[model samples]
Target chain A: MTNTSQDRILEVKTLWHYYGNTPALRGIDLEARRGEFVTLLGPSGSGKSTLLRILAGLELPTDVNVMTLDGQDVSNIPANRRNVSTVFQHYGLFPHLNVRENVEYGLRARKVPAADRRERALKMLEQVQLSDFAERPIARLSGGQKQRVAIARSLVLEPVILLLDEPLGALDEKLRIDMQVELLELQRRLEMTFIYVTHSQEEALTMSDRILLMNDGDIVQTGTPEDMFDRPNSRFSASFMGVENLFDAKVVAVSDAGLTVEVNGASIEGVWTGASLPSVGETICCGFRSERVQIADDSTTSMNSLEGKLTSHIYKGKYLDLTYQTALGPIRMRSWQSHAAPTETARIAWHKDQTILCPKS
Target chain B: MFRPPTHVAPASYMSFVLIWGLVALLPTAGLLLWSTLTMENFQIVWEPSLQAYRDVLSSGRWQVTIRTLEIAAIVTLIEILLAVPFALWLAKGTKSAGVRTVSLALLTIPFFLSLSSRTIVWRGVLGLNGPINAALLQLGIIQEPLDWLLFSQFSVILGLIGPYFPTMVFPLYLAFMLIDDEVLAASKDLGASPAFTFWNVIVPLGLPGLGAGIVFTFVPMIGDPVVPELLGGGNVVVLSASVQSLLRILNYTVASALSVLMLVILVAMISLVAAITARFAKGGL
Candidate 1:
């Protein structure tokens, strides 16, 4: 995917916001570039939505200075003066207007001339592929149709930026997937700057050019999806992504090759390449995803192998989920169901790089 | 519903409907018949004539109808114009609940207060030597107490506005609140100014409330007697007072005829306005 230009379309410098005496956002210095699809991926209460509201000018920041839209100072500008459009999950279509009227609403407001408004609205409705239903009352529309009309309404305005707050949260799984594909296509075609917010990790990975993973009102990491998945920087990211097994281990030795760690009275060796690597006797947390652990066959296994009793086995579509009681406590592993039958004793092993270590609190 | 076999019948439902219809229509029919009968001996009253209708359509009685329409139209126009700005302020103002509650109190306190008491209070405030006149004098803004403030068309209008302004405001406020925040954002993002947003998005969205407010405030004002009787003195005679005079004198025929005329005019006004509003609304009434 093409990245947005480094020249910022909007910038915030040390922005702060509060509701009454409670702070919702504190010293948030964020920027959005032109034509970028940046997803603010966070759990709720992480200030992602609040940040979007501030950017849209719906809520005033308590203390901040900011520039927006080609370096124009928009710190004190009201919502109506800012060049940003927002689409909410509710799809907020005016019930009293027809689809065409709703689409033309912004154009008429800007005094784009009556003749031109009609033409532009028609063109926009066609873009969303709702041209046949332009004259239908909004109340008569289905949920997806209403969403399409709302998108058309926002798009017809030709805003500098579009902020979508969980736009597909209300849709069913099938419809949500369809809308996500359509939205990505529209974003590419229009070259509009998009700031999408969602708590769904799948949506963040699929739609964002860059994901800003937020937690507790702070961005934990901002990087590509591959970087986030293959090399998570924090325990929170690792756990949130999919790591199912974690254990506190003590580093016994480190060399240019690898490090040996002790966990649950068992010595395990792992690659130690992180910048925050610990010294001898320092405590660290080791993690591995459920899918990465596998049953070790003594006939073919070479390194980092363990012998254990099979506690339970679950037959998943493509793999068998096996729980084993190992010297390092209970560890979960996934093996192809076709290759393995449930045996009381099973040997398990994984590569050293598959085991990740983080500084233990 | 599909027709059943001869075992079940429809007599019971039809009988119930007939009974309810008779119960509703009987009083209106009785009133119409009795009003048309000329009074003689109690049981022998008969021979209806055009005399009652003539009296109602006479110059002396017709002026009250005209006067009532004039006052209602003026009040409706003023209320709608004033309420639009106030509604916009309420909808787009500070989101602080305390501020909103206080502003709403300003509208509802008088709205719920006794209409008579509010009129009496205004009567005192707008008196020749009342608080308003005294303040103007004390501020050296005027040397004379303004006679236009009391016992004139203005005071009557003021009294009507004081009691009925919230009717205009609450609906318009609701309409404005119903507008989506995204619509306003979209307008701004497209380079719309504040004034343009108000004219195009805010006004069109709130038009239903405006139309309803005008009908609710103006329609009742036409038949209301309290404001004119207290503040208007003999300056204005609305249709309700005319109906009252005929009723008091036992001229039920003329009273009924005058009511019918007013009802017809009110219905026409409502229909005309509704048609116009429905045309522009695009999707709904």
Candidate 2:
């Protein structure tokens, strides 16, 4: 195995890939430093997985734009030449081979000496805690065990970086959670760069150092999970970040007092900081995270409190999601540890910063 | 919860199976008992004779068995080496779907062609003034028509190879199809080239069918009388034809004994083949 030089592991520039004229990835620019866990998060058909395939050299971009690893141009390099390993949604374990042979397969392909391959493969089997089942068949292992074996098989080469394409998507919910934690722990222990691709928001939020939010074959936004969640830059981002209270409104006026927007017979005002302030009668929409909106308290300070009837409530262990029918239309809010006035109408308010503004088309 | 009625009652199934089993066993059981017992007309019937068995061992019947086995072994080896590559190509190569369908049709055409018609065609094709000789002569590849093309071991083998290629190819193809493309991609992503992937990943997965195909083609070739009868002429008398001669001469006892001997040899060959295949097919779940 080669030593990991502390250099940029991969850099993709303006990558555009297409499938028979249908755009799969458009103008994707990304860079992975030597050892970072970057997860590509998006909905289905968001080009996240396509981007991973491009980076792994399994796919070629429509244009031969520069893609480099450790400063070496590898845009057209075959997957075998790149020292990157990928774990697929299906484990793709060779059904015919036992665990030990499957793990040793890559080493043999690399033309490692027989003695070295055995040594390295046995060590890898031990690392994945499958030493006891080294001789056991791959098909006999449970889902989690098969995935671990797949990881061990890929990791045996000590790959420069590992690409995981929805590796935990096939597992049940409890197992998926367990695997997420396990994978994060493994990545931390190995200190190897992991480029994970998934469409699950919770998965991205749970385990990404930084997430690339992709939409419609492009990277819509890229930020740390907290940044993307707490301050999503657009309506799409807000929705993707699990912000539920998004509404279309028109800006009625902006003054030193504050900015006011008229919506559904209710006028809501908040401090505005958007670069392009909407003119009067200009259509705009705003969003807020369900948790950011709360039941009005006596100590709270806000000029934007709305009197709304409590329409529906669903209790979660930590928080209850409440639907409030105010004059501004139904607004969803999340409350922690308590429910207020579910029987009839109530007032809900939030700080100015909690409100997000976006241009409405 | 209501239970569904069992259509095949256990008693009926057992009785059915036992009847078929007895039907199959009766002839073999009869042969075994006849081979062991003294006949009422001892001189004419059984004669309590181990003589046929002795004749089998002494009259170069053992040599014929060896020759039959050797020829089948060589044929199986050659068939596998040639057929496997084509099978793999047919199964995994990026040929157009129409081409694949057509080529598969070509492989299967010989199976439906009458055996007698195929042999007659081979005779003409391989004849001295046949198309092959004429083509070779016109191309200046040969000065004389090759008389050795017909009525030889080579011709018999050519005949065997023609009919048996599909048998060999079909199983290997099925096995190759069973290999998941993800597994192939995973191997590639793990830094294996196409060649390495085929040997380490594809071949192991496809072995059981490869083994099965070899067994299917080999076992029958050992006892096939037609190939030798039409193509071997007087130059070759494989074991099956020799057994036929015994039957023709009204040596039913000897023919039966010869068939039983052939059966024993076939069982041994099958077991050997099974053992080899079982070694590779383990853990293929």
Candidate 3:
């Protein structure tokens, strides 16, 4: 968390909120500098949506927390009065309003002159490429068009921070991907700080400048996409960041070579990058990506090679998805090309850097 | 929850239509037949005559028809104005199932007791020496008990509204409850005040219920003669009251004519309501 400084557009500290007796956000500390696209990434029930609602002033937060926008404390400001907007997951398009009217709502609320409001709304419509369908009723518009209208509605307001609560979650995977690119482009072009909440880990990795990964009402990690994907600090963080090859390994020793972790009576050394590496005789998790695993040389003296029996190979066009069965567990790898059939001997290796070490949960 | 209909025999469909015809259409035909009959020189006549129609259409009877419609329209308007806000509160204010069920039970208590008893209760409440006058007297709001409170048009309206308002309330509550909380929240989030949201979102959403409630309360108020009989004190003459008085004096032909006229007016008003509802519904209001 950062203080309310000159460059920061929004600052939050020690924010605790509750729904009845249930804690929705516990000790949340976050800051968004000017034009920063921060993502609140978490699974369902992790309170990411709750946090977004509180930030948007839709839900009054319950706590002695400090929240500021542009160096002014706005913790108690009502949603309409606050200089913030939101795009709900369903787009929250008014079914009675046409696309133009929906986009013109905020400006009208702010008492903008009718002529200027109409011109600006039309310009915003053109910006979102919805000018051609401006008069279409919301019920007649497709889902993607509604989404663009929602975006245009908020962008026309030019709020300090736009809180998006999984606005693209309702779209299909293909459309969702396309919208992700469009959203990132819109964010960059407008230079607006967007505090977007979503459970999709890939979306956070692809779109965010800084991702605040949350779990069970607690922020687990906050980092850039690569910082989180490459240097996840815990078992939950590693798996949530899309590293799937986590395994229980007992620490045998730590030395100049690396930390030696014994897995199923096989000693495999891994490079530990975290501060205060685990001591000897402690159990921790070792993880690596499926794409990082390769066929081991089988004769190398490195401490990262393991032999297993091939269970199956799925042809994925660009990559061969192989599952190898070993005494430890199933080790999956996505090789560039198919090697052999299932139920065959296989040896796989990953570099020391790719072999991730995480605390056992 | 519904299974696909494998097949419905044509015989069953024909029976359904036949049953509908027997239940709904036969009575209208009967009314049409009765309205044209003649009462010749104080004796029943089989010949079709326009005398009953002429008697009913006389200027004297027009007063009764207009008064009947006015009272029903007033009651329906008052009920609508009262029921919508009450229904909104009942649906949205309390989330407890027990409270909603108890409130609904309380609303239905007027239905169980006879309409005549309900008129008696209103008489007690609106009478000169009743609780209303007593409270007003004790509060120094009035020096004497109000004279026009009981046995008047006000008492008749009060009597009918007690038993009929729930019909308006229940359906309107269902309509208000159908609006998702998110929709209202979205309206507020879009910079609409609570009053604006109620006018723009809640009223538009509840239009069908408004139409339904109007039909529910209006038809019975216009048709019922008991309330006016007990509360009118011979001062008010509604169409139904006129029809009742006409029938008691062996004016069966005139009575049937008045009844037919009331039925036609009700059907016309209902058609108008249906037209307005259909138009707004099509507009997606």
Candidate 4:
């Protein structure tokens, strides 16, 4: 919740990384406050995991202007000397060590006394609810238990920041949800900074206090979950965030309220969500969520109404997805209510407040 | 549709085990039985006796047995020390595929040659007039050709090392290759230094292969008749040489007794290695 620089625990500036000749991270700047759960959400081949590795000191960046952890410069420190831990995607626990020894490894490296190390390791294992499994071999553990042991191993080190690279990506759906809640609870309880990298947007939206959406080696947008879902600033962000309807439109009139754009010879009203206002006669993209559309019976007075024929209906258990072929395109709507049969002519209307207009690129 | 046989018949299984036991265990049992009988007047005595065992101690053949064990143990230790780091580098250090392939091919090439032929090349390299002495003389490190470099314990041990090095390396290479890079990265990320990671993670995970390498190198070095014969220059007599001389004199009972002693020592050494490795790596390997 604290977003100011005074409470910043980790800060990175101008970080660049290249794998051979291909640039993976391009001059990215990142800042996280104390106890902030910041999620880097991106698809595969995005620079999210690379950025996390550099922050954890497991990787050396091609160039970095400055990096600090807890106000201490950590740009040159290696992973072992740095006070940061990482939970690998496959839960890379040592196969030779038992559960307790695996957790005690970091303490042993730091030369903690035997009695104190055992006590601390057992206490951390108890926190992860794996105290009974202290003597168990790593091969005997299930997937979820291995995940918990991986977490316990990192947490026992008491690092400044914990970097998780798709830690729950290996779990099944039910267990994944369970671990998501458990992870959030653990982070809140310990008040530790967690930098999680995941490609699942729903997981990011559900867990993060701030989300940095990355694409093509750059973070295109950074905002809260609601802001990201409601008002995406680019065409990529809108499509990545599950906005179903998008149209290419040219602005005809600009007013204080919003802009009126001409879409397929029909004048549509939408609010501008970009940083700068677009002048009249400028081309841009407009998008809206499928759930925001409604079947309007009296469409003659509405400002953003489209007349179309219902082409298909998909039953999705919790909701129905209705596709309508209008002059603009095939517009899809997610409706919770049962609608008219297919081939019925209907008018769909969306409020201007629910509309989002951004740059075409 | 054709389906493979799921289970073999019980009679066939028993017969298969019987055939293996006959081909393997019967000869060892015969040697043990023969060691207990003594020769009388150039003919075999039916009476069993411990005279051959007593003669082994009195004739000082036991010293040769101990010397064989000592040299084998030293050479095995040296091989382990050299092979581990080389195997580790080959498995995880270099990123070049060509280097790995070339090194593996080199290690495997010696396997195709006979041990005598492979070891003969080292004599040419370590002899007084060999390239090693030539190089040392040319570099001004030695005034004369070093006689100790050939036909000594050093030369015998050196010859044994080259022939058995691949045996030590191949198993270790396999074990180190199977170690996940992520596990090593996790170790570093968990605040362990490089040295700590090598001792705690790399060594324990590589124990099975280390055990196999030790057995493969040590067992054969004890009974090898070529290296000590060719390089020891008739001064270093081992158990195999004593057994050969005893057989030439028709001392079959004492020869069998010495062979049984060697077998006992080998079993004990292998078992000790297995116990230590098993203790260090529980539920692993």
Tell me, by DockQ, which candidate is best: 4
lDDT of 1 by residue, A1-361 (tens): 3435446787788888888888787777777778789898888898999888888777778988664665787888766667788887787676667899888877766667988999999999999999999999888988788888878888887778898988999888999999999999999999889999999988988888888887766677788877666566667877766677788888988887777899988888776535666789988777777777776656442356678888888888788888999898888887766466778887778877777766543
Query: How are the candidates ranked when ordered by DockQ, highest leading?
Result: 4, 2, 3, 1
Q: What would the per-residue lDDT of candidate 1 be over residues B1-285, giving only the tens digit for each residue?
A: 765544445786678678887996666566566556554422425677655567767758888888788888888888888888888788877677888789999888765766777787777889997999999999999999998898888888888887778889988888888888766665565456877766666776777787788788888898888888888777777788888987787777777777767767887988887877677665432
Score each candidate by Cα lDDT.
Answer: 0.79, 0.81, 0.83, 0.90
Q: State residue A301's C-alpha deviation in candidate 4, in Å.
A: 5.8
Q: Is the docking of candidate 4 incorrect, acceptable, medium or high quality?
A: medium
Q: Tens digits of per-residue lDDT for model 3 on A27-88?
A: 99988988899999998999998888888888878983689988888888878777888888
Kindly report, for each predicted structure in the order presented, the TM-score of its chain A compared with the true chain A: 0.89, 0.91, 0.94, 0.96
> How many residue pairs in model 1 have overlapping backbones?
1
Q: Each model's DockQ?
A: 0.37, 0.56, 0.41, 0.60
TM-score of each: 0.84, 0.87, 0.89, 0.93
Report the Cα lDDT for residue B153, model 1. 82
Candidate 3, RMSD to the unseen true structure: 3.5
Residue B69 in candidate 2, Cα distance off native in Å:
3.4
TM-score of 4: 0.93
Give the CAPRI class of candidate 3.
acceptable
Clashes of each: 1, 0, 0, 0
TM-score-sorted candidate list, best first: 4, 3, 2, 1
Q: Residues A190-218, candidate 2, lDDT per residue (tens digit)?
A: 98989999989899989998899999998
**RMSD for each of the candidates:** 4.8, 4.4, 3.5, 3.0
